[model samples]
Target: MIKECCNKIDNNKVLLSMAIKKKRYEALVQVYHSELYRFAYWLCHDPTIAEDLVQETFLRAWRSLESLQDDKAAKPWLLTILRRENARRFERKQFDYADVENNTLEDNKSVTLDDEMEQTVIHRQINKLSPEYREPLLLQVVMGCSGEEIADILELNKNTVMTRLYRARNQLKEALTDNHEPIKGALN
Candidate 1:
């Protein structure tokens, strides 16, 4: 009888632990899902692929949640996971190429046609930047990561991250100027 009662207590403990873990995981998903999806979409330029990447990233995060020590580190942690998931896509299979022009732009806000055109131009310019420059800029601008967080996610020193960001801004400014699409205070 004592053995059976001890077994029941142990089972209850296990259940309680699982319930806590599930709650934590759900909270994380709610907080970070949209940011992760935006970052993924910019990285791949494909909505479908971005959605898949976010799903895969969250799946991996769920599997390895116990390894994450700090809750404050969650954004950078999730970003790193997402970057790896994006990399894995190349290893798994070659994806069919899609024309960037053909992909539909999804905008929730009401903006004028001129504003939309300007945004398209800016996006194209951003996409033209090399990955080394582009990735840092995206992390900073899109993901809203700080210099330290960007460095941590990219596995680079903070100085290196800042330098890349500087160069990226310069390059983007020059591209916009060359294209005659002067977006005032765009980089600021």
Candidate 2:
């Protein structure tokens, strides 16, 4: 399968040499948009911003669709675009620190009682992470992108991505364990 997809890339240029850019673009969007939006949502913690970011990423992808190599790498290739667009957004306005770090989880305690309690627990915990850690976590666990792909997307060394992913999950585990601290209640 890997060999077949690589064969499609007549040359090692994702943006330029693909046989049908339009068809590829459509396939890319259809295949990865949901994953991208989820990733962006986790990054921005806002669905509206996530939607806008995904749109911007796709538009940029269309404009420079030729730079991508290895159709298999499309997911992370698109992610690199989204992350850059996210960084550029800060130059437009001075966002408050609070905008990014959502520290008010304590205020939404009842949210843990929902039907999809496990999902809510996980998202709530994920939301609690700083973006530095969250981005790697989302890329690996959510988007299912590989270490090489994430390293490319974040422009970090692959080892750095691996370490960060480890720390991210470790932090998540600690946070979730800390959250389960109703010792007296449980003891009763």
Candidate 3:
């Protein structure tokens, strides 16, 4: 009877460990996978590569899951992994830049020509922003990360992240205003 009890306890311990691992992985994927993918996509500007980077990031995270000591650190940890994965891509190979004609930026299906033109202009202006300014803004707007989270992810101070966000907004406003003034003048 004692032998059977010992076997049961051992089985229960094994099951509990497996369950913990499963929950951690599932929770990580459920919470951060999309955000990580978006961050990766903005970094590389390639959907396929972004998907691969997120996959690799999560794989690394799963391997080191126990090292994550704080719940709040998960997002930044995942983002750091993703950023490293992106950097490693450059180390592995020197990729040729894609030709502009081959780039397939999405076109919003709008019935009005003005709406389509407006979206195109906005997208172009965003693409024009330097990486320093662009990345923080992407983390805020796309991933919905707070300034502190962005700072942690980007390894910048919170003030720096705020400054980048400010500059990014100002640059976009100026670009749009400059573009629209000519159109308004023509109408008048």
Candidate 4:
């Protein structure tokens, strides 16, 4: 009888724990959805890709939610998930060299915005850079991650992250300062 009673108590505790986990997941989805969406949007310029990235991020986060301890670190944790999702997406999709080269050669005026033309201009220029340069910039600018955090997300050494970020900024500055007339040999 005692053994049976202990088993019943254990089952009840498991059920209660499950209920709490569900509630926390729901609350997390509510609070971080927008931030995740925005981060994904900047990662991929397309809204559809952003939605997919955020969805994947949340799905992974849900699976690993038990490992997460600090609620305050949720934002960075979510960002890390999104970045990994983005990388996995590229790996699974399997881009051809021709396709990648062709894409890099394309013009990127699509990054335009109404209110902040100059900033938009700079953004488009940044967008034009190869992903090696673009990823770190977005992590820093859009996601507000520190250098070490960016390094971890991008899976690079801290020095490498710093170098790429420096190069990205310098390239953007040059693009912005270049003559108003488009460069003669812009890829696209």
- Report the number of the highest-TM-score candidate: 1
Per-model tally of clashing residue pairs = 0, 6, 0, 0
Candidate 2 Cα lDDT to native: 0.78
Per-residue lDDT of candidate 3, residues 1-188 (tens digit): 99999999999999999899889889999998877877787677678888999999999998999899997899888988888888899999878766422222353454466655665566567778998987788778777889999999899999989999999988878877876743331212
Tell me the lDDT of model 2 at 89: 85
Ranking of candidates on lDDT, top first? 1, 3, 2, 4
Return the clash pairs for model 1, or none.
Answer: none
lDDT of 1 by residue, 72-181 (tens): 99999999999999999989987665554433357788878778777778888888899999999999999999999999999999999999999999999988887785
lDDT of each: 0.91, 0.78, 0.80, 0.76
Model 4: C-alpha RMSD to truth?
6.4
On the 0 to 100 scale, the lDDT of residue 162 in model 1 is 100
Q: State which candidate, 3 or 4, has the greater lDDT.
A: 3
Q: TM-scores, in order shown?
A: 0.93, 0.71, 0.77, 0.74
Identify the runs in model 4 with alpha carbons over 4 angstroms from their true place.
69-72, 92-116, 179-188
Error in Å for residue 11 of model 1: 0.5
Better of 1 and 2 by TM-score: 1
User: Candidate 4 local accuracy as lDDT?
Assistant: 0.76
Off by over 4 Å in 1: 96-98, 102-105
TM-score, cand. 3 vs. native: 0.77
